[model samples]
Target: MSGHSKWHNIQKTKGAADAKRSAAFTKIAKEIIVAVKQGGSGDPANNSRLATVIAKAKAANMPNDNIKRTIDKALGAGNTDNYESVTYEGYGPCGVAVIVEALTDNRQRTAPEIRHYFDKFGKGMGAQGCVSWSFDRKGVIVISNEDEELDEDTVMMDALDSGAEDFSADGPVFEITTDPDAFNDVVAALEKKGYTFESAELEMVPQNYVTMTGEDDVKNMEKLLDMLDDNEDVQNVWHNWQQD
Candidate 1:
């Protein structure tokens, strides 16, 4: 696995123990709202974006009732909150490229708050596309090996047959990659075969990674990520920091 992929796995492990469950739920809820509005439907059957978000929520162990409630609320007449997708690019400590994806009702407030973290914990915020050009958007599906029931070769073949571009094992997880447009289709194919994911989402994959070893740089990078993760508007954060 690549360094960023490893770092992603580490963060997933840490997130479970992190005292940000409520914040996580809030972020997922906002995602549901955005997916519904953007896809022009609240039903996952017709909304691929919403289905992807629902899958992500389930991977996070979000309760079924909570997920249903979120969808119902989004479809309800009383829910009128409008969110727009926004992305910010920047360099974090030790010059690690960072990308943040957010859904916000107020970019005026969200932009400044994000810039504050970049200024405090990173070098500073960069202009749009400054760092984004160095990344490619890809569909990523993560499957856990905790159950010990998965056969590596079988899984690999299944993923390949289902439209995955690449597959690799990272310790206890299998990371599957696909073209962004084929993400939902591959995910659905896997689901039909009774496979579940640890996490699945479209993510920014860095073309090149930056490795940070200095103590201060690593600390600052962690702090910056935590701050971004805690922000409800912030849905996903990607970086090229190769942890050592």
Candidate 2:
């Protein structure tokens, strides 16, 4: 979870930079478009994926108009271009493993571009299952435990009751995981209990982590991961690089 926290920090720093705001919006919009398509409905109330993405976009202070426009495009019958969700697995500099989840209208165009980025960074993409075996699909939800609103034990008990598989502390928040089908119920239960979180979304958790001992190696690895994250087709990037 520390590695995930560090990665989130890096993304936050990059997103805050003035030069990256446009890029951030593009990425967020793409996610909304894809989420609407995947969820099969434009209304967030009926579409869990769209609801989660809307929450994330709202957190970033993205304009409501922009969000509505994107959703309308997704629902519009005139739209023809179709995007497919794909995951790419690979190892980064210093041998850190990575998984890149993308939503692209053209895999033919996206695959080559993604491969090139890795090749240029002295890292190479792996076959379908090469690095995927290291990760397990899980529902990850982040919730605030501030104001002593929910003690750890109380939260843990409720989470387990709601079908959560595991729980951990990620910085000042709790990271809860559950079976994919149980995600909605777990989150709803937590919310009903008055826990307000910064963010909640599904994620891939690595079964094992590759630790970097040398500072130089860690720096290089970070640069490579950052480059992978900037791709337009990419939605989320996951890795197993423990960070303190």
Candidate 3:
């Protein structure tokens, strides 16, 4: 129901700049591997989960060749990656709720590294369900309208008709939210009408937001996020920190 925060903005700007393209694509490829194995198909047409992940890859501007290669590799013989989905719930400075979602082959190595990050901020990590209670898992789709060429009313109507739960416009960006189960269906519905996306993926939407007023608190929070982002195993990080 609002603009995605500073962490999101940082990722967008960096993604657009290709500053972390290789690393980002590597993480996404892991998602592809899991999606293919779990969904039991390499073809996105028949696999809703794979379709959603492919939409995410497209939004990230991952190359078509890379995507195809990853899918092929996933379906190939002797592919031996077994990634377990793990979620870490924690608090940052000023009681900011943070959740880190990861896919790791080895829990032992990934667990200690994640714990180290939280411990850096005074044992910030907590039990799995601790902070997730305050968030809703939602499918969010974003569209860029920087030139104001996309009409708000038309877009809103289209999104609503396509089964979006909510629509919000901030400056030149439009966000459409949907139920996680209906995410791929909504995306496909919109795409059929020639709508392109800036980002389309499931996310942990925080129910409330809090600001970090102290300088040290903000610095620690930023560092914590950076450390997580640097890890190849970590996929998504969600937080309630209100950032500009």
Colliding pairs, model 2:
none
- lDDT by residue (tens digit), candidate 3, 75-170: 989899889999998888888888999999899999899888987963478998999999999998988898888999999999999999988886
Q: Can you list the residue pairs that collide in candidate 3? A: none
Question: Could you give the candidate ranking by lDDT, starting with the highest?
Answer: 3, 1, 2
Which ten-residue region of model 2 has the weakest summed lDDT?
Answer: 1-10
Ranking by TM-score: 3, 1, 2
lDDT of 2 by residue, 172-195 (tens): 667677777677777777777776
Q: Give one digit per residue, the lDDT tens place, for model 1 in 96-132.
A: 8999999988999999999999999999999999999
Instruction: State residue 152's C-alpha deviation in candidate 2, in Å.
Output: 2.4
What TM-score would every model get versus the actual structure?
A: 0.93, 0.80, 0.93
What's the lDDT for residue 196 in model 2?
59
> Number of clashes in model 1?
0
* Residue 165, candidate 3: alpha-carbon lDDT: 90
Q: What is the Cα-based TM-score of model 2?
A: 0.80
